[model samples]
Every structure is written in structure tokens, then in C-alpha cells.
Target: MEEVLKKFKPRVVSTGIKELDEMMGSGLLDDSTLLVIYDASSFGWTIGVQVFRRMIELGGFGVITSYSFPISLLEKYALTMQYDFLRDGAEGNLAIVDVIGSIYNLNVNLPFVYYPGSIDSETFLAKMEAVYRRIMKERADSRKPVGISVTVDALPDLFGEDVAMRILRRNLLMKELALMREERERPINILLLNRERASRRFIEWLSQYAEHIVEFRSTSISGVERMIARKSLLPSFTPSEAEFRFEHGNIEIRPL
Candidate 1:
């Protein structure tokens, strides 16, 4: 285990929230899978963009699979969060797969498919297979490990608990398949927004496939939030209480 860790020293990527990053010892690992649980109003998109931005800054590619936000909305939010959308090489490195978009747009540049917001599991699975093939081809042609962010907002509305579990399971399996084929690690980040159907059993099952789990909660302090990590692969260190603040977005330790 120590040998493997040393060989694959975890890379930390900040979430743009200082307090959250501090709690996780600088940031999340680059090649590991992470699950982010929060509500729509809980700054989930903000965190997702931050992770994508970090990947872009590192000259890496990322994919955002949005089940709720439209492409236009995602673009708007990303720009609002200070991401430069018009910059050269932006589209080349960042790919947004908006299921809300028309199917015609899927054939453009990247191999993406649109779901049209109304589809059965079988149909959805077929479209996903095409997308997966395209992604693999793209990665092969570009020879870059892509960071995939799959945001399934209001999951319960899309599929039943059993169906959702199956979808998620297949997604993770597909990621692993890509990882093996590319001879590179593909980090898949899942954002479950306000998904009440996601029971503890489901989460526990998912946890086995995840390397990190980040839970975000809002605080009374303005511009501040609390983040907790259920699992991590980093060296442990005691945090000082003075280092944390409610408004300033700092994470500090205090006497219990």
C-alpha cells in the first residue's frame, strides 16, 4: 500500500472554497474518484466548476455531464464564476455534455449525445454507449487523461431508486473500463444534488467505488460553509482553531 501511494502521490486540486480545501489537506487527489453530496442551493455547481477550472489550469481536459442544467445555463454560471469561456483552447480542453440540448448538436466536434429530457433506460443506455465510445476515441487521439464531472441533479425525477443505482453502477464501470484502455487514470467526480432517493445503503455501496466523499453544508456565517470528508488518502495533520472562520471560508481546528 505504501509503495503504491508513493508511486502515485495524490495530487490535490482545490475546490475554490478555502475552508473546504483546507479540510482536505490542500485539495482532492487528481487520479481518485470523489462523490460530492449537496443540494442545488448548496453551491454544488460552484464546487464543480472550481474542480474543472483546476483541471484546465493544469492543462488537462474535463467533461461535465449535466442532467439538470442546460448548456447555456452551465456556460453562464461558469462565466459568472469567473471562468474564461472565450479563451483559446477552452473548448478543446473542457467538454460539456448537456442532455438538455438537441441531438443534432452531438455530432459537432466532440462525440456527445443529447437525451432531450425524456428517455427510457434502454434508450438512455444506448446513447450513453455512443458517448462512451466517442470519449474513448477522443482520449486516444489526444492522449490526455480527462477529468469527468457527472452532475445528476434531482436524480429521483429521472429514474427510480433501482434504476438510478444501476445507471451509477454502469457509469463507474465504464470509467474503469476507460481507465484500463487508456493506460491512464480517469478521475470521475459525481455531484448528487438534492437526491433524497440516495439512501445510506446506496451511498455505502457507492463509497466502495469512491476514493473520497465530500459533504458540504451551509452555515449561518455569510460566504462560509462547512465541509467534511468521510474518506481520504492523505497524511493526517491536526488543524488549528485559529485557522478557521465562518465568513472568511477558513478551516481551523478547535477543542471539542
Candidate 2:
């Protein structure tokens, strides 16, 4: 037991929330694909935005991908917390992979943002890679880019489930392969999924791809919700629920 223990030294990348860090066994594991399952009505996306914000602050190029909304809304989101989105983007610490905008062939207006001229799993992934390469090339000291995709459930509804699954599978495969090869340090991808909008099978598939899972459920009372670490690769992780509220630009998570 002593010999085994000697070889075990765990480390984590801080998520910027101390209590949440404890819930996830110190903090988020490196190269972790974390799934954030949530209901449609809850303030689920807030959790993801916090992670993205921290990633940028920590010198990781942060990428925000939204299938449910556009860049305009993301700008509004930064305003909610009074975050320094403009400065981060200007410094290349933040970027956006506008999936919806890319699908519609919208013109780009930001240097830190990327959207493909064509729509397909190949082009989409290529553009994401382009963003990654560009950031790392320009910022030699920056960490691997971390990303958060809001409302992954919308992908299926936007495209048929079959196509969306294919896209997801391709994305997972790419990330896993890169991680396995040690080409670069893989990023923490926080994917927010609204369970009500996706098929059961799709959620199951999502569970298989992620290294960690955080599930959120809203109560009948307005502005109150519960979150739990549903699944995790960390040995210290334990299943427990914590109630939280999103009000006045603050996230109040109460201990049970």
C-alpha cells in the first residue's frame, strides 16, 4: 500500500470556484471532457461561462461555442457578470467558434473568432483547429485552449440526430486521439446539454465520451436548482448534490 501510494500524486487545474473545486476532487482534471447536463429552464449555462472565464484568466485560450445563440448574446452574457470580455478577446485569451454563424455563412467581424465558409464536420473541425493553431502560434506561452459549448442539445434539433451524433463522435475521436498521442495537452471541454431537447440515446452517447459529468436539475421554486457530480474519473470524487441560485450576477451554491 505504501508503494502504491507513493506513485499516486494527484493534481488539478482550478475552476475558480473553491467549493466546486472540492466537489470535483480538488479541481478539474487535465484533458478532461466534462459534460454539464442541465434542464432547459435552469441557469445551467452560467456554470459553463464561469469555467470559460477562468480558463482565459489562467492564460489558456478560451473558446466559446454556442449552438443555441450567437456572438451578440455571448457579449450580453459577459455583461451579466461585468467580465472583461473585450480585453480578453483583444489579448487573444478568448475566442469564439460560432457554429450557428458558420452554418449560416455569416461574415466574421472579430479577429479572435473563427467560422468556416462551408458547413460540415470536416470544415467545422478544421476551423476549430485553425483557431487553436493560430492562438498557440501567436501566444507561445499560452496553455492549450479550453472550450465550452452551450446547448449541445440544439445541435441535434438543428441537424437531424444522426448527423449531430456523427459530428459529436468525430469531435470526441479527434480530442481523444490528440490526448492519447500527447501531441499537445488536451483541453477541458465543458459541454452544456439540455436533456429535454436531446434524445435519450444521444445523452447516453455523450456520457460515454466525457471523463466527468455534472448534472443539474431545477426545482419547482424559481431561481433555485441543484447540481451534482454525477460521474468522474477522479478517485477522490464522491456523489453529492448542492443547491444553488443564480441571482444578481452571483452564483450562490449552498452546502448540504
Candidate 3:
């Protein structure tokens, strides 16, 4: 019998979001998938934009499948973060698939996907499959490895609890398929916005499919006002507390 050596793909690195990246041991791995959950105020969307910017900076292509927020908003944030696809000659490397209409509007050049109105489980899954297939085809055609980040604005409303579980199950299935392909690996990050005690079951279910899990909670400390502290992926860290303040359109964290 002949022995075959597997080729190793490079890992995807984060864009210096210190705390967040550290939780994942350097950042998202290349060719992996992550889910982000955030409340309207969780700043999860902002984090996603930063990740996308980093991907582009690393000379990799990116796609934003948006369930909410206008395409214009995403573009504005990207620009604010100093991501100039056109000026930097990264236009061809970035794309966007906006599902804001009945038919998904894919802007590969811009790297965004928009979804309009409410999306049911069936439709959402179909569109996601389409996008994944397109990305895979693009990678094959280019003969280059690519990384993908999916930011689903709000998970609960999109599918409710019951349907959301089914959707998640489907995601796990997709991961299995991608793994079997041997052409790429799936690493996913899921962000949940609101921190509530009741959602533990849902979070636990998600953990089963996620390689790394992170939770963001907002706490008000005496004399410190309101701050956000994260429960680390490592249990020994004791969930370091930090003062979180958003200003000048950016998220800043300081030691408490």
C-alpha cells in the first residue's frame, strides 16, 4: 500500500481584535465557517465587518450574507474601517450576495449578500446552499483557497426557537459535507447578541456544532457604569472582566 500525505491549508488570522481573537487562539481558521449572534447592541455586526476587512487585507476574498441591515450600511462600515476594495485593487477579491429581494443579488466584486423581509427555514437554507456552492466553485476555478464568514444578524427572529434548531442542524450537515469533500474545512463562529439566562439550552445546542464558543454579557459595575465582559472559551481564565465602551463608531475595551 502507498502512503499519501495530506496537504495542509493555511489558517485564517483575525484582524487584531485582541480579546475576541485570543478566545479563538489567534482567530478564525481559513476555509472555516462561524456564526455570530448579537443583540441590536452587542456590536456583533461591527466585529463581523472588522473580520471581513482583515480577510481582504490578507489577500483573501470574502462574502457577507446579511439577514438584516442594508447593503449600504455594510459598505459604509467597510469604508470606515479603511477597506478600499477599489483603490487597493481588491475589488475582484471581494464579493457580496444580497438577498434583499426574492432572488438573491450576488455582488462578487463587493462581497456582500442582502436578504429582504423575513426568511423562512426552507428559503434560507436554499439560498445558503446556493452561496456555498458558488464559493466552492469560485475557489476551484481560481485554484486558490478562500475563507468565508457568515453573519446572521438575528437568529431567534429569523427562525424562532424550533425552526432555528432545525436550521442549525442543517448547518451541521453542511459542515459534514464540506469536511467529506476534502477540498476545504469548515470552521464557524456564532455570535449571540443578547445575554439571557433562558437561552442556555439554545446555546448548548449550538455548542455541539461549534468548535469554539463565546458569550458576551453586559454588566453594570458600581462606579464603572455599564461594561461588557466575556466568558472565555478556556475555563481556567475565570471570565476576565473588562470595561467596554463604544465611541467614535468603534468598540474599545479597557481593563477593569
In model 2, which residue pairs have backbone atoms overlapping below 3 Å?
none
**Residue 186 C-alpha lDDT in model 1:** 45
lDDT of 1 by residue, 32-60 (tens): 66676664455543555565566556656
lDDT of 3 by residue, 1-256 (tens): 1112233343455644776665555565544444444453454445555555555555555554544444556556556555553443333555444554333443333433333324467777776667656764653234333333334324555567778778868876776665655654333343433434227677667655554444444455422223333333333334344555555566665645
In candidate 2, what residue range of length 10 has the lowest lDDT sum?
2-11
State which candidate has the highest lDDT: 2
Could you tell me which 10 consecutive residues in candidate 1 have the lowest summed lDDT? 241-250
lDDT tens digits by residue: candidate 2, 1-256: 6644533333468888877777877788776777888886777668777877877777677777767777777778777876767678778677767778877776568787766456664465667667666665665354767888876888877767888888788877776565445455557788988888888999999998787788888888888988887887788988878998888887877757
Better of 1 and 3 by TM-score: 1
Q: Cα deviation of 41 in candidate 1 (Å)?
A: 2.9
Cα RMSD for candidates in order: 5.5, 3.8, 5.5
| Clash number for candidate 3 | 29
The total number of steric clashes, by the backbone 3 Å criterion, in model 1 comes to 2
After superposition, the stretches of candidate 3 with alpha carbons farther than 4 Å from their true spots are 1-15, 29-38, 76-90, 103-120, 139-156, 185-201, 219-239
Model 3 poorest 10 in a row by lDDT: 1-10
